[model samples]
Target: MTSASMISPGDILTRAEIRPILGGSAYGGICPAIEERNVILYSDHEVAKKFGYHDGWLSENDTLGPIFEYTGAGKSGHQSLTQSGNKAILQHVQSGRTLHVFTRVGKITGTDTKTHRYIGEFAIDEEQPFVPRQGLGEDDLIRTAIVFRLRPTGEFDRSDSDTISPAPSTSAEFVPLTITSDMLEAAAVTRNAFTSSSLRSRSNSASLDAAASGKIAPVQAVNVSEFQRAASAATTVRRRKALLIEAYVNQLEAQGHSVGSFQLQIEGRTTTLRTDFFDATDYTLYEAQGSSDRDAVRAAFSRLLDYRRYVRHDGLQYEPKTVALLPGRPDPDLEALLASYRISLIYQGEDGKFSSAF
Candidate 1:
């Protein structure tokens, strides 16, 4: 409502947050130089070249490198984005989520007499908010704030020749050597003899019977069903519920949707997971695309059967019947349009694991 809150410092950025900054568009068209410029600065010159910034603007190149590349102009008419401008853009994107800013300072050596110092800094913001233009109200504003910094490094000699010269040669030189098969065979024989002698000594000193000592007992085989029963009984139901919710969140994130909240309805049980995230706020469940709900359900059930086989448990299994459910409508048989995946529901009892019963 109040444009969320500013992203707090010290938060680790997630893939969702990094995606937009790396290249995702906020309006309609892509930001031309931003992506290429970032690639040049953070990645290799080749990568930047792929994006059309081939001049090595951020690296070894003199005039076109990142150090000399102007992002935003200063008040003095220089074309370089101020530290504040970069921060603002990042913050605007974050929409008050958690963000992390990293700054580093290093020295660059030059081949000539003149030396220069520079700074390197970057920021990663998480869970930024986004509202569609169609959803905007007269007073409702879309704000993006970027949290970033400028890291100034120490100065080093900056000679034009330094850029052209190759890296300094190491003091020690490695020499190539060749060995014959006979030498290898002799070494292998000596190693085998030592190993044989060690084995012989151990065998001579060891007793065969348990009472005499040095006797190793064979491990007993465990009953698979019994182990599964014990494992299921020991697991906490609450933890399973948490896992289910986490799986949903991860799935949505993978689909490029920022999940804000989710409601899990299990009969009379209702659980909700909420966040002030951007993008999708509601969703409808559907069966996998191009598959019937019954078939989709069967596939999910098959996976459950495979899981049972893995745990060595035997039981009569039933496939879950899946359907599409909108906000308020009868479940539909249209499964061909929805994405589907298996999600564990819970460890219902000692003998079985419960999963999405849909």
Candidate 2:
């Protein structure tokens, strides 16, 4: 095995070949080759399935390109981000280290030695890196897992069959919901938007604002507005959705309806689900979307269906109404889709009043 820096993408090596070069236990999935300034990630999807887990899959190309979801270390219990390889994977960018991935291909005919296929280099997705997931542990119990979202930085073995499949439809005759006291605290937790990209744009905008107000030299504002504009454009979708939720909550409260959100922990799942807003007085559950476009409306509809199970809150004699809240009325086709599922639609009109369809 050559040094880590010299190892190119698609270079396969065995544990025996990697040990001397990487200086760590060759058996571990996350190996830090200290001398070479590289972090080698070994993903064995086949083995993961045998343990009742499915991860280390490649996703189709989207706007940001392909993403590989890799499960972090630890076979049982909840995995911590601040410990071991999880920390290394998180801070690899700041430490100036490269992430090289390898997937177990097969075992040598009869021996215990397994071969790996070098996939290529990857970087943690800056927007969202760690995703909480549920997987069975070694003890056959459900445990919390951390999935690291990795974006490819170079050419990888795309011919592998481990492509990420779309999530299965959530429609079922019976969906279980586990009530937890942490619902309010979890719902209040803000989504993280402080990425490096957002920070750079904020600094530039602050500098430009100071310059425009005569607090700094006018020349310092050169080309800063363009960067600031780009940053604002990047966050438009999230901001729009947030604003819609806030306005709807206020409207509900003004109408004598108690508005709140819930973070639900489904039975047997480590990941939790959060509702956009719930009308306690009227017994309505809402799933809001910023845009009424086809994709956005479809997503909101799907989520609303999944959340219907939560409408049967404790002490309630009947299930609450499921509603899809949109910034504006959806097209006739989309409205029909919601109606087919018996989901009510509520949209804000030009007059600032909400229009509803039951």
Candidate 3:
């Protein structure tokens, strides 16, 4: 095996030359050369497609720069961080190992040699190292996968064919819930599915059984259209806030007032933050908190401060009044904090009426 110094960026090499020069397996997506003090990553778009994933590409330019998303090592089932290759990549900074990346270009004709184009070095993004995504595995079953965010350390190959489009914004329109028997039944089922510990235990047991029997467990496929509906059915704090907004919007409509929400898409960011509710009749922007805790109260205040800048009324000359919406009244200190900023507080009383405090 030759020394690691032979490999350089933009150099094309075959599988046989990699092991002798890099000191790692010449196969697999992740190759860790311990003696070489290098962690080599290979991004093969063709192989990824077989597993129902399209990875190993650069994203559209953002504030920081374009980031490369590389799928972690796992061909089937759930990809765990505990694996050796993933662990090595995760702790590369602390371990003092350099990361080298390569992408498959093509193979030589009439032979068994595969060609790879070295794409320079990279480091994991400190803000968000990796993201958990759901995709089909090699077995064609849904599984959780890990995608690592890598930032370039130096000049690297940038090609239009290797760049990916920006991800879709996460924005949802408000949905009014109707009080019907079937709707109640569906809600009850969803609540049990989320909160019941026994159900979770049974699910774990079923997974084990499937593994023992060499059978893959069935799971729902990813569908963008049903994302909001599935999110609303969860028993999370966000879900509770959605319900609160729905109730308040209904009340405003009953009083012959127009109400809706605002979707704000900030530049240089992929996510779109949506306000809880906006009263078009009176030009008031509402930010809802699921709980009256201090943290939730503080976050609601911060969001209101940010959202008010873009919120506008067509005919009004003044800015919209900012109000914090909660399920119940907060402590005196929290209320004082909101009042100091000149932000109003609105809570639902036990009798199901909205009470405002300023």
lDDT of 3 at 211: 23
Better candidate number, 1 or 2, judged by TM-score: 2
lDDT of all predictions: 0.23, 0.61, 0.64
**Residue runs of model 1 more than 4 Å from their true location after superposition:** 1-105, 108-326, 335-358
Cα displacement (Å) at residue 344, model 1: 11
Candidate 2 per-residue lDDT over residues 281-310, each given as its tens digit: 777788877678999899988888777765
The weakest ten consecutive residues by lDDT in model 2 span 181-190
Whose TM-score is greatest here? Answer: 2
Q: If ranked by TM-score, best first, what sequence of candidates would result?
A: 2, 3, 1
Using TM-score as the measure, name the better of candidate 1 and candidate 3: 3
Give, for candidate 1, the lowest lDDT window spanning 10 residues: 127-136
Per-residue C-alpha lDDT of model 1 across residues 36-104, encoded as one tens digit per residue = 233212222222223222111122332322132212111111111123333233233233222222111
Give lDDT tens digits, candidate 3, residues 207-308: 222322222221111122333344443234544454466567768889998775565545544433456567888778888877788988999999988888
lDDT of 1: 0.23
- How many collisions per candidate? 34, 0, 0
User: TM-score per candidate, in order?
Assistant: 0.16, 0.55, 0.51
